[model samples]
Target: MKPSVSRSESSARCPRCGNAFDCAMHGQPFDCWCREMPPLPADRLDSSGRCLCPECLAAEIARVAQGRPRGA
Candidate 1:
């Protein structure tokens, strides 16, 4: 038999909201702004060497989207 793990056991905090929650704890990975605004390459690493929180990441996305030119 195998053992199970909880989100908190490996979950990360939401950089935007500062709320702690697990996004990707398993071996799977996904696109997350918490890691970067545009989301750095999968191989890239954040300053903290860990994934960023969802809240902070979302805020960054919104900010960038707003900064874009009207035509862009």
Candidate 2:
């Protein structure tokens, strides 16, 4: 279930860290900013449909590269 983003920007919180962030997936002049990040592995993608903050997202990608399980 993709997070219920509107046709414009919205304020959101990272479900993992509870950090506040802005989502611009459907904002003016551009696509989502997460597109800037490398694609996450299908198995590693979050199931919650909420977007992760940059730090947590980078950590997740690193964990995938290191072959570590989540939270390890």
- Candidate No. with top TM-score: 2
Range of the 10 consecutive residues with the lowest summed lDDT in candidate 2: 1-10
Candidate 2 deviant stretches above 4 angstroms: 1-9, 28-30
Candidate 1 ranges beyond 4 A from true positions: 1-7, 14-17, 25-45, 68-72
lDDT tens digits, residue span 1-72, model 1:
122233565567543344666665343476433343465333333456555555545554555557742223
- Residue 69 displacement in candidate 1 (angstroms): 14
In the predicted model 2, the residue pairs found to clash are none
What is the TM-score of each predicted model, taking all chains together?
0.43, 0.73
TM-score of 1: 0.43
lDDT of 2 by residue, 1-72 (tens): 244443333667778777766777557866767888888887777787778877788889889889899856
Model 1 lDDT, residue 49, Cα: 58
